[model samples]
Structure formats: C-alpha cells, structure tokens
Target chain A: MLLLQCPWCGDRSEEEFACGGEGDIVRPLVPEELDDRAWGDYVFMRRNEKGIHFERWRHAHGCGRWFNVARSTVTHEILASYQVGDDRPELPE
Target chain B: MSRARHEPLAHLALAAAGETTGPDAGVTLQAAPYQPAVILRGESGNAAFLEAFRAGMGFDLPLAANHVNSHAGATALWLGPSEWLVQSTTGQAEHGRLAAALTGHRHAIIDHGDGQQIIRVSGPRARDVLSKLCPLDLEGPDLAPGRCARSILARCSILLHPLPGGGYHIHVGRSFADYVWRLLADAGLEFGVAIGGAG
Candidate 1:
C-alpha cells in the first residue's frame, strides 16, 4: 500500500485516502466562444505523464481535506503533497 | 411512557460477553455509551472564534495534525484544518456547554452524541489489539496522551484518541459500532480480553 501525505494530517496509509484523477483543471471562461473541439479538449483532455505527475487526493477517512499530490506514474513514488491552492512544488531529483 | 435509553452497543452486550474473564486479561475494554459529542466547525484563523472557544471550553483548539487538547475535563481533538470533535471525559454533555458558549458566533456545531459509541481499550495489550484493526503505526511516543488520529479501523473510519495514562478511546459512529466491537473482541481474544469498568 502507498503512504500518502495530507497537508493537514501528515503521512498516513494510502487506504485512508481516495485519489482524484488529475489536478489543476480549469474551466473555460466562455464555453460558447469555443468550438466543439476546443470544448472537448478542455473537458476531457488530461496529460497522462509517465514521470512526475500532479494529481488530486483527499484524506477521506482522516482529515477529509482535499489536497494535491505529485507522484510518479512509472515508479509509483509520491514526490510531494501540497494544499489545493498552493503552487505546484518544484520536483526534487 | 418514559423514554428508554438506547446504547449503541447494548445489543452486543459487551459487558456480558467478556466480564470476569480474570485480572490477567491482557486487554480490557469499557464502553461509554450515549455520551454527547459535538463536531465544531469554524475558521481556525478567526481570532474571535478561538477566543470564544477558549472562554467556553478553557483551552485553545489544537491546530496540529492529530493533536488532542484537554482542559477542564473536556477533550478537543483536531479533525481537520477547521474542524474538531469536542467530547467530555466523564461521558457527560460538553456539547451543551459549548453550544451555549458559542451562541451568536458564525460557526457550526452538530450534537451527534446520540448514537456514537466511545469505547476505552486499555491494558498491556492495548497497542497490540489496535495494531490488528488499524493501519496507522501505533508505536513509541507518538501514541502518547494528547494525541489523536483518524484512520481506518476494520474498514470503518474511527477517531483514535489516547488517554492520559494509557489506552485509547475508539470513537466510532453508530452504524459500525457493533461491527467494530465484535472485531475488537475477536482480535483481543488471544490476549484475554475483558469488558469491564476502567480495568
């Protein structure tokens, strides 16, 4: 099992949390102004990075706070976790 | 007709199931049923709320992760950045006092003590029993008093709070109380579990 860090509750077992796919998704300001292809890209497109990936997670069984986690899809190693609004942290080698 | 008191774990009859099992019972469990529990929600950064809370409960809300603060017999456990669980040490109503104290404030208080079960698990094998049910590492000084945490216990979410001397208070919701109790009993059987008063 993975050990995920919660910004409010510290490191806890992965079972206590639920991973939300992707992170930092933004909605287009004017949907009507966009063509069908542009809207589809904004709605469904995701950067499935194999290396350091930014994702969303919630400490569902613990603090119940939603935070962002930077993990590696290849290694399954969690790089770092930060609060929802905080800027994406610089990756550490 | 006088309203009959309902306990969360009365059906399991924990007292009958494990009483008089002997002093050598490596683990002892006690139930504090129908106690008043209050879930307090407010901005931690708001000075007014903090001041009012202290004036009402007698201490600052513990802001640290999984930290517990006890003052004047009431326990305030940190649940989230802006959420807390306020419970009385003596199985009484700390909710009443807190609700009255925080009146007119922009905050949320839910008196959810009705169906919650607060069980005390103590003795030499306390940690052993918990290790069976929970995923959190319960070792060393981390599980000491003034510490509490929320984690998965036997597939149920529980608030594990450590008491002053030893043992822990397993705060679980009504639906899973019986399930948790049975699981705890099953896990502690090898250690000679006893259900009794503060043993």
Candidate 2:
C-alpha cells in the first residue's frame, strides 16, 4: 500500500485519501471570449507528465484537508507535498 | 436536549460475538453508551477565537495536527487545522455547554452524535486486531492515551482513540457499525474475542 503524508494529518495509507486529478486550474474570466476548441481544451486537457506531476489530494478519511503533491508517475514516488495555498517546493534537477 | 437512548448495535447478539470467550480474551469488544458529541470549526490563527474558546470551554484548543486535549467532561480532537471533534468524556450532555460557549464567535458547531457510535475495543489484543486493517504504525513510542487518528478499518472510515487504560474507542458511522464489528470479531477469532454489552 502507498503511504501518503497529509499536510495536516501526517503520514497515512493511500486508502484514507482521494486523488483529485489535477491542481491549479483556473477558469477563464470571460467565457464569451473563448471559442469551442479553447473551451474544450480547458475542459479536457491535462499534462499527464511522464515524470514529476503536480496534483491535488484530499485526506478523505483523515483530516479532510486538500493539499498539493509532486509525484513521479513512473516510480510512484511522491517528491514533495505542501498545503493548498502554499507555494510548490523547489524540486531537484 | 436530553440524551437519547439509541444504540446502533443493540441488536447484535454476544453469543455470536466470538468463538472464544474468557476474561483473558485477546480482544473484548463492546458498544459504549452514547454521549454528546459535536464538530467544532473555527480559525485557529485568530487570537480572539482561541481566547474565547479557552475561556468558555475551560480548555485550550489543540492546535497540533492529530492531537487531542481533554478537560473534566469534554475532549477536543483535532480533525483538521480549523476543525475539531469534541465530545463528552462522561455520560452527561456536553453539547449545550459547547453551544453556549461559542455564542458570538465566528465559529461553527454541529452535533456529531447523530447516528454515530463509539465501539469500545479493549484487552491485550486490541492493538493487534486494529493493526489488521489500520495502516499506521501502532507500536511507536509516541502512542499514548489521547493519541488518536482517522483511518480506514475494513474499508470503513473510523476515528480511533487509544485510551489511558489500554483500551481503544473507535468512532464509526452508524451504517458501518455492523461491518466494522464483524470485521474486528472475525480478525480477533484466532486470538480470542469477547463481546460485551453497553455499560
């Protein structure tokens, strides 16, 4: 089982958390300015990076806080974790 | 409001509780009597909030994550940075006191005892049975009374509290009560399980 360290609840198993697909997506201020493709892109596109990916996770069963996590898709290694409003940590090159 | 007499597991029979029964059973499971419980929410960073809470409740709000602090009849469990689960430590209703204390503060308090149950699991094998489904390392030196965490037990979300006397109190949703009890009973079969009634 994958162990996740919640920003508020500390380290816990993956079972107690829910993966919120992507993080930091901002909606267009003016929807009328966007075409169908642009709107579709905003709705459907995701980076799905090969290495480190930034995503949101909710401690569903634990403290019930949502936070950010940097993880390697290939290794399933969580590189860093921080609170929702906090800045992302500086990752190694 | 007067405390209502409602037990979710009242229908479960003790004879079917376990295969082994003795005073030395590894795990002794029972449904604890109902008590007043509430979920309190407020900004921990606000000094006014903290001061008001401490002055009114007679105890300081536990700021550390996963920490629990208690007074004579009330215990505050930190659920999040801004949230807590507070309940009566005695049989007396404590919610009224809670509601009265935070009267004008910018805070929120809601009853948590609605259809929720605290299953008491004690004995030498308490930790073992809990570890069967819980993911945390229960053997760490920091483990003590008032140490608690929210975790999954048999795939059901539960709030686990390890008491001072080596017993465990698991707060579970009413619907998942039977499943958790059966899972604990089944897991403790090899070690010996003793089922008792509410006290």
Residues B22-66 of candidate 1: C-alpha lDDT, one tens digit per residue:
679998888875666789999888888889999988898998878
Off by over 4 Å in 1: A30-36, B16-23
RMSD values for the candidates in order, in angstroms, are 2.1, 2.3
Judged by DockQ cut-offs, the docking class of candidate 1 is: high
Give the number of the best model, judged by lDDT. Answer: 1
Q: Proportion of native contacts found in each model?
A: 0.86, 0.90
Model 2 ranges with Cα > 4 A deviation: B1-4, B13-20
Residue-level lDDT tens digits of model 2 in B53-131: 8888899989988788999888998878899998887867777777677778889988878668889999888899998
Clashing pairs in 2: none
